[model samples]
Target: MTPSSSSEKSFNDWYEDEHIPLLSGVPGWLDSGRYRLTISTTSHAPSYVALHRWTDLAAFDTAEYKTATNTAWRTTVMEKVVKKERFLLQYKGELCNILDTLL
Candidate 1:
């Protein structure tokens, strides 16, 4: 997601309101993380990374994330502000220990 260098308001809104909530809603969506790059270095500008985990490869493949994101963007209150393109990514692994809990 690229925006004009002068567009601070757009960036804040996109992150806080749109991108975070929309991506968080996908089925089996585990997590999405954001990082502000080079926190103490001379390069003060921020760059973000998103981390996503799914239930499994097959489940992710059928999740229809892009379609759902587009539908929400076009049909909800989110439509008023966000303008970022989503790029889908996938990986394969036999995931283990999805959760641990104690009662």
Candidate 2:
């Protein structure tokens, strides 16, 4: 999701306040963390990347993923303000250093 810095940080902070300790309570989900990537000033607009990592495939397939979701404000914001979508696909080969964890 593309979010302005202020909105992005606000959403993340709100989510952390709402989730955090709660996410660890959700079964099958472990080591959940949020990460932000630096923006490229050369681009037309400043941007940031948000990363959410689940323990493993099973963690993602489990009930936690279904029952635990975005906070109300975030949900409303996405529903009202954000109007873009992308489908994620799992493929061979590492997309980035994310695999470094396993290595």
Q: Which candidate is the best by TM-score?
A: 2
Candidate 1 ranges with C-alpha deviation above 4 Å: 39-46, 58-64, 71-103
Residue pairs whose backbone atoms clash in candidate 2: none
Clashes of each: 0, 0
Candidate 1 TM-score over all chains jointly: 0.49
TM-score against native, each model: 0.49, 0.49
Give the Cα error of residue 61 in candidate 2, in Å: 3.4
Tens digit per residue, CA lDDT, model 2, 1-103: 4455446566566557655655666765546445444656565432433344554556556665545565576575455323243444444565667678788
lDDT of 1 by residue, 1-103 (tens): 3334555455656666876676666677677776544464544333444566766555345455675456543344334422344566776656466564332
Model 1: lDDT equals 0.54
